[model samples]
Target: MIAIGWVKVSVCFILSSLLVACTPVTPPHTEYDWKLPKGFPSPLVPEDNPMTTAKVVLGKTLFFDTDLSFNQSTSCASCHQPKFSFSEPKKTAVGSTGQKHRRNSQSLVNVAYNSNLTWAHSGLNTIEQQILIPMFSEDPIELGITGHENEVLLRFEKQHYAQLFKDAFEDSQASYDKIVKALASYVRSLTSFASPFDEYAYQNKDGAMTDAAKRGMELFFSEKFECFHCHGGFNFTQSSQHENQRLDLRPFHNTGLYNVDNMGAYPLSDQGLIEVTLQNTDMGKFRAPTLRNVEVSAPYMHDGSLATLDDVIEFYAAGGRGQGINNPLKSPFLTGFELQLAQKQDLIEFLQSLTDHQFLNSNLNYPPVSH
Candidate 1:
């Protein structure tokens, strides 16, 4: 009886120790070595998705892996090439299996800071969620893995990928959510803040920028042109952004790209934000992408309608194609401002100044192939 009583006391002591240890202790916040360039604001990072070196490495591998596609043909780099600032030079991107996409692949530049992704769809919020649409969608199929999900997962279940999956995720088994997380993490790391304009404007270098670029900057910020209304901020993007930011939310705009049939109707082939909301007023409305690296991402606009920076300037100078005739959503601010030939050249130079050559040849290129 005495021995039994001693055993019960020992059990009680162990339980008491475990309870003391289990008392909720707050974990210390990890400090990331974030380097915010001059005039650049801090990027919004979700608390649940903290940045880690291992996560970023895994994300990078997933991003460049073509195995994510239906037939293991096209990777994210297939559409969003690193050379074009993560945008496709083609008006519409071709899928892994030679399927042509309807809309041009949007640039991933500064997308980490964007509040909403895509040209018009508000349904896409997080990069992780957005990656799935292209990976699994059927209508206007992107990666073409709709009916072959099980097959795709099985391919990834190989011993070669087992270690990669285990390292990236907290679980033993690889899943779709873990894939999305890795891709999103890699994309978020595609940050660019070292352009010539960045060195000149924010760094205050006396002669970092050319005289023409300076003139163009003046024109861009001048009240007459009012270019800053939509393209203002450190990132040169309209306000759409995520948390940990001090800026206002971005609003989608219809820059009078079209008024087909003399009515306020955009082409059915590409109906910007109207696709998701199904509202007439939302027709031709698209999120204003950042002008950073704008010069290289030519064939401008969502449809790749504009060909060159000069042509873009001319389009904006004329306030879109319709002008003041039948378009309703045309910004009242754009009143067809007159720019001289010299000023136009200067503006183009300034746009070119935003290009970061280093980013174009980044190591994010496709992995080396084996013989």
Candidate 2:
């Protein structure tokens, strides 16, 4: 009886051990190894579309797929070219079906950090919201998919893309919501961290930037130019809204790109923030994009008015249009400032230092292939 009781106790102990071992443990998520520069805050990843290698890969394929559009001619890459800091050099982007969009294609560099997107529309805060406009807007006809939703889906359903949609969503189907989420995930993952400025400033490395760049950095932060006031911070954007951002969200700025009618207005058609709000105070206001890759992301400005970094410096130095006249909304900060020839050159050099060649040529190209 003693031996039998001992055997029962041993069996119970073995069964308890097996139960503990078989239980599934939620292992730490080590998927994305984000390596941001020092002083750079973590990017705001959305809750619904969590970062995963699989999702990013899927998103890249979707981003470059011309089939996403109604006519099967244009993809997301049409406007946001990878070579030009993911921004087209066009004054206004031409759509898939030959329609021209009003605004210039905004840069994708560090856009995951933007609080507000687009020249107008203060409320379109998330990348997901910003994406739907191009995909479905009819007046402009970006993707030209206003009434061809079924046709678009049908094309994807014919091939492996249907399966790809399932993999990205972890469901057996792909909806517009899932498509947008996947594309946004890929956009957020296009973070640039290896710029020369990042190396010299954050990594504390010597001579990572040229002497001209060092001089330009001085001019950028100097009291004369005061470039840092608006184009400051780790992301080099005024539209930052993350927790550790040093300053509050100062998304809009009137850079004096237009005063077409001399009524303190931007071009009537391209009226910046006022288009959405219909408020005078919001006139000519647009979100400030990150200057991280500004050197390549030209022609500059919300309308692509300024063609080059040199032109940009010239615009700011001249203090915008109607410099002599005082516009009420012109941020008291951007009042006409004088910069010398060498100083301007140095500033341009500094802007160039922000270009990360590695990020620009990153091999994570469009269309995922098998491992």
Best by lDDT: 2
Q: Residues 166-199, candidate 2: write the lDDT tens digits.
A: 6666564767887888889888888998989888
Q: What TM-score does candidate 2 get on C-alpha atoms?
A: 0.86
The list of candidate 2 runs beyond 4 A from truth reads 1-31, 239-249, 322-325, 363-371
Residue 341, model 2: Cα distance from true site in angstroms? 1.0
Estimate TM-scores for all models: 0.85, 0.86
Worst 10 residues of 1 by lDDT: 20-29
Question: What are the RMSDs of all candidates, in order?
Answer: 6.3, 6.6
Residue-level lDDT tens digits of model 1 in 5-103: 677677777877888443332343345544667556667877667766556777777677777787888878788878888887887878877877787
Structural RMSD, model 2: 6.6
Please estimate how well model 2 matches the true structure, expressed as its whole-model Cα lDDT: 0.77
Candidate 1: residue 49 lDDT (0-100): 71
| Local error of candidate 1 at residue 235 (angstroms) | 1.8
Off by over 4 Å in 1: 1-31, 239-250, 322-325, 364-371
